[model samples]
Target chain A: MKQRLSTLMVAAVMTASFAAHAQQPAKKAPPPAKAAAPAKKEGITAEFEKFREVLEEDNPAELFEAKGEDIWKNKKGPGGATMAQCDLGLGAGVVKGAYVQMPRWFADVGQVMDAERRIVHCMVKYLGYKEEDIRKQPFSNDQRTPDHVSVITYVAAQSRNLKIAAPQKHAKEIEAYRIGKEIFAYRAGPYDFSCATCHGDDGKRIRTQDLPNLRKPAEAVKAYQGWPGYRMTGGFMLTQQWRMNDCFRQQRFPEPTYLSDSITALLAYMTVTANGQVYKGPGIKR
Target chain B: MADPMKIRAQMKGDTAEIRVLMSHAMETGQRKDNAGATVPAHFIQAITVDVGGKRVIQGQTSTSVSRNPVFGFKVKGAKVGDKVVIHWEDNKGDKRTDEAVIAA
Candidate 1:
């Protein structure tokens, strides 16, 4: 009888232990499956960054490349000549590998010319298009690229993968470079901000995007070379010249004239700083 | 025509892997211009993919899709030397069609 009672007691103890184990919910059986993916935020951020890198592999700037070629080949002015023979620092009829070396002193114009200004010179000298009308619009809208802007993207794309080597020769180029440094440091806008306010320090950021210090050569290459790019946010294809005008506007200063000395000088600073990097644009921009 | 879409289709064993970069704004129309003008609603509504003239994929999209949309997908039973074609139509009635051949 004692043995029978002891056996029954042992069975009771076993059942109680089993019930207690099931009640705690601390074991890895059922609850762990639900907690398998706990680090949701980190996983998502890593995934999004990977996705962006993959998306940038094929840039959409080629669309403007086609349009720019067509515009260059077609006649626009009463002079009835295409811009095929207009000089862009590398001599007439040379569109390839000329962009990375521009913002240089042009003996004909007697000033350094960026892509837009050089194209304007060609429009005037070869195509006989009025300079005033060309400057009337320096940016593109929803429908079409302004002639000069399209030409800039086209020329820049041709120079892609070539080293950026804008010359610092000529007394005028040296003077422009000096003035560009002054402008980058000058702080007299309503907000008392210059390009230095945000870009003076490396690793500084406005929001989620990191602002590349244009003063630093390594970062300047990353920032300056990829312009005339298609900006996804504004749904606009922007030129480097347009970007200069907008930067001043953001600081509440009078906007810089398109391809003006003020604008070109700042670009000269960036170009000189980025002397050896290869051009890899028109790049995709946020 | 606008620039042709950049596409790559590669055949691996029995499947075809394709990647495409399309030039489009995919504008949601919820934004405004610098002049405070209301940007109109314009976006791609549909995309279709075909293998050697046989339709393989048809996708629908909205403003949720980002601008300059990049897309990728896989197809079964593909071999080298087959042609892959892709086309997309936007709400504004603009369409672009481009094709690539599957390379081994």
Candidate 2:
């Protein structure tokens, strides 16, 4: 419980209205003096950055973290087992610093796994849940949220402040990384835009939201760290797995399968690109 | 299974600080899904806080509020070990109440 956290963590929804109010005024002003300005990205991007500063104080993700911590220890599923003993690649039941090492090798599945995929694996193997049932509702929607998402928020938060060091020792992990790199570059869909179109270049944005050039190390580090974040726009906690899927949606491509090998490969590519950077997340995002 | 709300209550001298995070769609009914179907509005209309079974703070909310909203308040004349209960009622009449104990 972060009850006394000195940092001013805002209640969700309250600040979004403020951000919306701040977004339009600058653009509506007489354009003569500001129109010729280079890039002209200052209006909404500046406002969002300021808004992010305020949200950064206390992320709503912490609420999920609290719920997740309880779920980790409580018995559930058909097997009546707690998720506490499931291995996160650092050995059984070890949570701290486990997330940063993931998208790494796991000998049991014999392939590299992302947090969602791994959690699903644990759910099946340890808790006796069906994979198809688990995959059916992986993302949170208007009606409800799968327990897995909060579990992930709990798992990912454990690595807060640790350096991202995704292992490439295994051939499978290396291959996953290579596949992820390629996925990051492969362009297609209605817009013919790859992740590169937005994330490949520096200082790119869709509207007011700033896009991080995940190709570069520092930006990758910063972007990669905060995922499984609370999104102000969507009003939900989104996992990195959800991040990959949403990106594909925005690209006008068909929906990407949750925790598919391709998505894991993309994560391998990103976390690896962000290697050696300090992770400070379970972050709040716009 | 019902959706859970997170509650934290910390006693600061004579006053107890309480914060709550509620998980709800808060769907505005105006938005559409990817399939273009209208998502009906579902949101918390009111929130009440009680300590030691006594009513204290009551507030109202609307659809304009964001999903999974967070709210915090300070209660006077509170002490450590006092039980803090938060009850919320949505427009659909769906209700959730969660409680926490104040820390000394």
Candidate 3:
């Protein structure tokens, strides 16, 4: 009886999906000559791409970058020290081309740190802002954006058009990459889903959104770059760290703590895999 | 105090192309917040563009505009090195003005 019921359920699901497809507007139906092509999906993707192209010309992310530049140069926090002197891997006060080489081993912290982590560290060290206070509301919401996100946006924009060259020189950097690779494939949580489940292969998508294959260099660059994007839906500026946390939530896994090492590891792996691609600065997202 | 706008003016042939990106909440007043309170309406109401100290474009906007809205204008008789100033006033009485020079 149970076997028969399971079969019946499967049949119902198939019928429901067929009905959903049938309900699509007649205007969206492909002509008979293009029956063999995935015309419907391609059309939607193309439309989205066109929309993105139009919005990309005047991205709102630039506004955040400007705000960040102001914050970086101005004195604030308890220490009242400007972040202008903050060292972002290359040396103190160097802003250009520092973003593309992030998730590197920072000897001062003795850990592999990504761009967001390094920015927060500078905020703490130079600006005297408490780490916990900053972590309390790290992600942007509809109403407000955290200062660090804007700072990262500014930093990332400085590296615009630079090639991604996430260093794997140090032992710790290599270890972070390895751990990131593992985390990408490790499956857990109620959904039994991993990042690789959705992104490990090409031509994968969730609903209408195409998922880039993280394992392939070409596709990995697509996934890695254009982050720290300005999300049009919410008009909020978000960083890759927020993206990674949201991914975990979608998989029904426990969200990692803000500025955690594991999140840095994941970023290291993705950035390293996407090495050599020119980052197009901060991007606009649908 | 309101944040400043980003203005870019460039010479496109004889006409000067002016693009402005303004930052605002642009709340429609129809939407509710996470705590179920109605968010107040706040949006840019009037916009004016001055080219070489002459008013070239004056317009009004409403809640329909998106947050951090971008506006573009084209003005004749403006040359490179001409000053383009954009000023906007919101419904809440907040205002911001920013200027840029037309570039070749």
Candidate 4:
């Protein structure tokens, strides 16, 4: 199965690159500027990496983590119950190392759920929040961030340095992974683009940002790690689900419903593929 | 109320390294919103750090700082277990104070 996927990906990359080259105007740029472009790009990328390293030492995500800890222990919501008893597949109140093992099957809900999805589910089931209300503004904007994103950040921080171990023991979990793989390769929409178009091969980049090859385990971890990240541009917390949603938007595809199964399936595929890699906790992103 | 800041204080050879992460919009009031209305300038105007009951840092900041700003300071003659308190007041008069104990 893996061999066939890689072979297909090579073909896709060939056509994609050909299309890119064919679209360029038959005009030559000044030779000097063209010669200096790659070197300048490398310099900027290295400097940006250094800046990120410094910022990571004092990540603003820590503030959200503190806030999330408060919400988990405090009594609020319509149910007036605390989320301290909520189970994250590791047992109720067991937060340590739970984030890395998520996108797992939950028998109670009879479905597979990612970290954000499960947290929202617990908020509804235990804390008595209306799913509709929570879904209304699931993402963060310039003004404010919804509570659940903070909660995910807090939870992810607890699993720092733990290996990714998203389980596939359950039949449904296996099913979700299969569906996720199909979804990744499935191409449709105005551009006829799939996730593979940008991320199926090594050395693919969108401008200065390098796209990780999710099909390979080493590169797959790059996709899984550093999520539920604190984006410095807008200074807002964002989750993997939001990243996936934004990708669809960039592709000009219809937006997936918040906490939808399709997103969970995709997460399962990515997380399981990234098994055994260490999660560096909530990250600071440019 | 604003979110609580995350403060870390660690002792490095008698100097306490204090790093604070404060949560604020730090709006410069220069940028227009989606509706084209100017965003009101709301940034931390004052910051003070106290270690072991002694004032160590009293600084002023402005709209130039980014949102969710981070600040680091090193205080000499600090010991382990010394209390490190960070206080900040924004242009809107909103204030927050958070403290941490110096770790070896």
Number of the predicted model whose TM-score against the real structure is largest: 3
lDDT of 1 by residue, A1-286 (tens): 3322111111111111111323433433454544576653343344434444544665566667767777787766665777878888888879888888878898987888777778878877777767788778768776556777767788888998989898888888887788898999999977999998988887787656667898887898877765898765545578888788888898899987767888888888888888898888887665
Docking class of 1: incorrect
Global fold similarity of model 3 (TM-score): 0.88
TM-score for each candidate, following the candidate numbering: 0.78, 0.77, 0.88, 0.87
Cα distance off (Å), candidate 4, residue A94: 1.9
Which digits, one per residue and each the tens of the lDDT, describe model 4 over residues B1-101? 77788888897775667777788888889989989999889988998878777777777888767788877776767789988888999988899998899
Name the runs in model 3 displaced over 4 angstroms: A1-41, A77-80
lDDT by residue (A177-267, candidate 4, tens digit) is 9999988888989999888898788889887777899988788887776688888877789989999998888777898999888999888
Model 4 DockQ (Cα-based): 0.18
Give the per-residue lDDT digits (tens) of candidate 2, residues A72-135. 8774757577687699999998989999998888887787898878987887777777788878
> Largest lDDT belongs to which candidate?
3
TM-score of chain A of each: 0.80, 0.84, 0.85, 0.84
Indicate the TM-score of model 2: 0.77
lDDT of 2 at A163: 90
Q: Worst ten-residue run, lDDT, model 4 chain A?
A: A7-16
- Tens digits of lDDT, candidate 3, B1-104: 89888887887777677777788888889999989999999988998877777776677888767788877666766778988888999998999989899999
Model 2 C-alpha lDDT per residue in residues B1-104, reported as the tens digit of each score = 34677777887766677767777777788998888999888878988878756677677888877777766667776678878888999988899989999887
Backbone atom clashes (below 3 Å) for every candidate: 0, 0, 0, 0
- Tell me which of candidates 3 and 4 scores higher on TM-score: 3
How many residue-pair clashes does candidate 2 contain?
Answer: 0
